[model samples]
Target: MQIRRVLAATSAAVIAATGLVACSSDSSDSASGDSESSEQDGPIRVGTTDAAKKAWAVLEEQAEAAGLDIEIENFADYSTPNQALEQGQLDTNNFQHLKFLAEYNVGNDSDLTPIVATEIIPLALFWKDHDSLDGIEGESIAIPNDPSNQGRAINVLVQADLITLKEEGLVTPTPADIDTEASKVQITPVDAAQTPSAYGEGTPAIINNSFLDRAGIDPNLAVFQDDPNSPEAEPYINAFVVRAEDADNETIKKLAELWHSPEVQAAVDEDAKGTSVQVERTQEELQEILDRLEEAERNS
Candidate 1:
């Protein structure tokens, strides 16, 4: 979408210093703006966490060939991208899944919506000393502390039989919901970024795929992981997100659809090391899933 040009030529150095990379120079004058009245003539300022991945380069090339301009803004943490998108600093973002998006929208009273389904990266459990989930009774396992991911991590433990929840079929089980006496291991919640370090410190951790690559841990070495193809994994399907007002923008939709291009998909596969399960869902289907998740979040 065409946004107001907020950054002048002099700010390019500062933007680069903060990790915002422009995928194309054609729309250098276009950066940030109001989503309501703008046309799709300028660069689509897209925010993401994995901007360094080669898939972005491929997608940029594909978008250029398709007559669309996109700018990639990189954020260091998971929380900032959506906030940026909500604040109108970004035209769209593709960093989080529907569950996380639901939590953000419900918690903050925002209406950021998903436009296209991307891929589901499995959350895996890894350990430094143990090769299998055997004989690890009484030990503690670290999990992500964020609301959405923490629940998924708890589910991973439940699937591994290392822990059991007090209630059956809880969608987002917290550590408090764990049946401590009945469970084999204790639950420790930490920041998502520190999970690998927790693993390095001799604790078993359910690490997100983003941290595994940078930590030099092999995805194949994960002792256990949730099944991406299962029905329970529906909420974890990542997608391109935008404000509710811009959800139907044709240019943004076209840009989001480019993620499935053969060249871009290949780059994504190479970057994910065969661990990512690509997902396809219509915008209506995705909105329905998000609605259900948002209802759950509200009820919780």
Candidate 2:
């Protein structure tokens, strides 16, 4: 895949650039307190887990050409970016999907909002021993144990016709929801980081895209994946998020829209290794999805 080619050619460059910023320290001071007054005070601090990706550099260049200054802060893990943004340390972040954001918002009593849709990096089912879903029956599959990804992994199995859920239309179904008597395979929930290892252990696994590169798994080798364009996949769409008060800020909105620029999008496509399916949802539509997810989280 193109991801392999990019990694081989620019792994060193990526590593070097990755050192540019560590995760920002937590602060008791709420940065959101002064957000409105300081909206244009300095470079728009945009937090991301993929700061080393070529797309950020291209995005910076494009934003500069358009008279907007953006500073990309790299976070080592998934939990910090929104925290940084909520605390007023960052003007925006572009690392998580709507479901993840909803969980964070509902859990923390925060109102970080999605400004625009970016792309969906598909969660795919990989099997080392089986060439197709038909090759496995009454066998076990490993899925992510985290709330956000586990539900999606279960949905992937359902989509592949390997499992049947007891009820339909669940936003985040768990293994307990599966009808074991009717299903083709049982599931073993494991840490998201262990899915590739589970695959190596000769069990079929549904792996997240972020773990694929480091595990030396080719995305194209996956036997099945959820459809990114489907209505069921809306919650998984990643976006550039900001504090709710700044959702309509012209500069931040423009910065979010800049992700669709040809140069930036091309760079994103290369960095994603062709797993990213581009999505273009209006801000209102994105918020609608987020609201539904937040409601689901509250109910869950």
Q: Which stretches of candidate 1 lie over 4 Å from their true place?
A: 1-39
Clashing pairs in 1: 4-33
User: Which candidate leads the pack in lDDT?
Assistant: 1
Q: Residue 229 in candidate 1 has what lDDT?
A: 95
Query: Per-residue lDDT for 37 in model 1?
Result: 42
Quantify all predictions' global Cα lDDT against the true fold.
0.83, 0.82
TM-score of each: 0.87, 0.86
Give me candidate 1's TM-score against the actual structure: 0.87
TM-score of candidate 2 to 2 decimals: 0.86
Can you write out model 1's per-residue Cα lDDT over 1-300, one digit (the tens) per residue? 222223223233454467543445533333333345446755788888877888988888888888786777777667777766765567789989999999999988998999999999999999887789887788888999989999999999899898899998888999889989899999889998899999999999999989988988888888899999998999999999988878777788888999999999999999989898899999999999999999999999
Clashes of each: 1, 2
| Poorest 10 consecutive residues by lDDT, candidate 1 | 1-10
